[model samples]
Target: MGKRILVVDDEKLIVKGIRFSLEQEGMEVDCAYDGEEALMYAKENEYDLILLDVMLPKHDGFEVCQTIREYSDVPIIMLTAKGDDMDKILGLEYGADDYITKPFNILEVKARMKAIMRRMNKREQTKEEKTLVKGDMTIDRDSRRVFIAEKEMNLTAKEFDLLELLAANPNKVYSRENLLNLVWGYEYPGDARTVDVHIRRLREKIEKNPSEPKYVHTKWGVGYYFRG
Candidate 1:
């Protein structure tokens, strides 16, 4: 089945270009011009991915992303202004799977989208139907869901991937750069801080106290590991 994607932006020209490029790839594309309309589309359809602009009328991309996250873990990539580091970080904090700066090449955008979908597909194809139990947390590999103390936790796509990797490995430490390559894809053009933000968010969700995390641990100068 061809991937279904929703492209949200205030700029009609940008949306037109992206929709054209993605449609040429044989994927189904839906376009929305503002955050409210984007949210409406998201609630009604199941999309493989979403390309959301940071600046939009009504709620804006960050708000839209956060609202969708309340019910879905669909992969979302934010489009931010060039050199806007805050926008990128904010996007991740709000549950975005990734981000691309403005003035981006359509080729690069396609590559990023494909990479995320590829990883998701590989995971679904290869993982066995089993659960990983560590302390109070439970990871359902087959369904890509995590639960703590029997209550289901809301984890984003990247968060689930990162947690599954670490929980499966026990105490194996992974450097920020190594994790970025492994979890986000080797071709991903992101800094180590991206890993940091995801880690913090994961810790907040699963840990009893995020300030002193029990499941995900920092290795001081090295990186992070899951203490099974």
Candidate 2:
């Protein structure tokens, strides 16, 4: 069966365009013209992915995204107008899988959609192979689940990638640049602080003591290492 996608946007034309593009790739598409309707549909149905617009009537995409995250982990890719970095960051911080600026190429949207879908699908495949236990922490690669004792941990895509990378190689010191390339799958621009933020977040979720992290350790002047 084709993968299912829910496209939520206030713009009818944009919805049609996205639906057309996605359906061409053999995906099943559903559309919602407002945030309230989108949230309703999302709550009642299961989708492999959700394409959500930032601006909407009634509830707004950010609120919808935030609400959905409370109950589901379905991947969400937010759509926003250009120069809306704050919106993008807010979406990401609230658990969005990705964001695309308006006036975006249909091809770029399709590419990102496919990439996000690939990552989500990959996590399913690896869910079974992941079995790295460190003290109270358990990293299950198959379901892409991380657990501290019996409590499940919620991690962003990048955070999960970082943990998987370090846990898979135990005691290996990977520099920020290396981690950026490995975990993010690209050469990150600007300072390597992106890695730092993710690590900090990860520590908060999985560490018994964030100030004195056990699984992930900083090698001052170097980068980070996982103590197996």
Candidate 3:
């Protein structure tokens, strides 16, 4: 079977269009029309990616993203009607990996999906002898697990990926766009706040004091990095 994807949106036309287009690429497609159904479908099965609509009924995309982040880190690309950057920021803040504004071209959607899928597939390639340490925090690239102060910390896949990138290259600052491209390795419309949110979450889990992070540190007007 080809890559599997879940498309969530209230608009039947949009859902049908995406499903059809993705299926043509030989991808297995699952869909839901509302937020509740989306969440249910998400909880029931694992997919390579999720295309979630931001303005969904019942829980909305932000709510569903936040809830799903509690357990799953399947890459999520948000669909939003508003072109506002703030809305895009909010989606990313809620854990979406990417975003597309409404009235989008089918080809554009396909390109974004392919980009993210390519990165995912590339990362799936196994590597040996890569482990990073930042003070009390330890990261295992092979296991994709993190330990802080000798206690394991549960991290979503993307969060772990972000931490791995920074912790592995301590002292090398990364701008939001740089992190988005290198870490996500895709063209995402979401802004820098996405990186900020993940960093905050990581600090909250690994730092003794999130406000004064001893590991992940901001570079004033630049971006973020890690320190021993």
Candidate 4:
């Protein structure tokens, strides 16, 4: 079956354009005009990805993204106004996997979305059926799930991907640029700070103390590495 996607935006023209573009790729597309509607569609169906605009009629994209993080790890890409750097960072903090600035070319949008989808699909297919246990934390590669003392961790797609990569190669320090290229895909145009944001969030979810993390550690000038 073709990939399922949800495209949300208050502007009907933008939504229509994106929907048409995605359909051309033979993917299934669903549309939502506001945050409330977007949340409802997200809860009702399983989508391979979501394209959400930062501005909406109700709740806003940040709130919608944060709320959805409660139960789903479905990849989300935020659409932010051009020059709004804060919007991009805020979207990541709110659990969006990626973002596209306004005035973006349709081709760039498709390339970015396709890159994320392809990377996720490739990883899901290539991962081996095995589990890694470290200090009460369990990582099941087969299920792409993480647990602490047997309680499942509600991780976003990028968070899980970062953690799994670090855990799989303990003690190997990966630079921020390296991680961005590796986990976010080489086509991603995000800066190194994106890696920092994800690492901080991952530590908060999986660490006993975010300030002095046990599982993920920073190497001062170099980058981050997993201790387990």
RMSD vs true structure, all candidates: 2.4, 3.0, 2.4, 2.3
Whole-structure CA lDDT of model 4: 0.86
Clashes of 2: 7
lDDT (Cα, tens digit) per residue for candidate 2, span 108-192: 9888778777866775676545488877888887677888877999886667778988987788999998986565444545547
Model 4's TM-score against the true structure: 0.87
Model 2 gets an lDDT of 0.82
Candidate 4, residues 126-214: lDDT per residue as tens digits?
77648888778899876778999989997877798899889888999998888877876663455678889888888899888899888
Q: What lDDT, from 0 to 1, does candidate 3 have?
A: 0.84
Model 3: worst 10 consecutive residues (lDDT sum): 183-192
TM-score of each: 0.87, 0.80, 0.88, 0.87
Q: Give lDDT tens digits, candidate 3, residues 1-228.
A: 799999999999999999998998999999898899999999999999999999988989999988898878788999999978888878776778788898899999989888887877776764444777666777888778899878999887768888888877788998888887877566554466777778888888878899998888999899999874
Error of 1 at 160 (Å): 3.3
Task: For model 3, name the residue pairs that clash.
Answer: none
Candidate 1 lDDT over residue span 1-228, tens digit each:
789999999999999999999999999999999989999999999999999998999989999999998788788899988576766767776778788988999999999999888977886687764899998889998678899889999888778889999998999999988887777665345567888989998999888899988899999999999997
| Cα TM-score of candidate 2 | 0.80
List pairs with backbone clashes in candidate 4. none
lDDT of 4 at 7: 95
Decreasing TM-score order of the candidates: 3, 4, 1, 2
Off by over 4 Å in 3: 154-157, 187-190
TM-score of decoy 1: 0.87
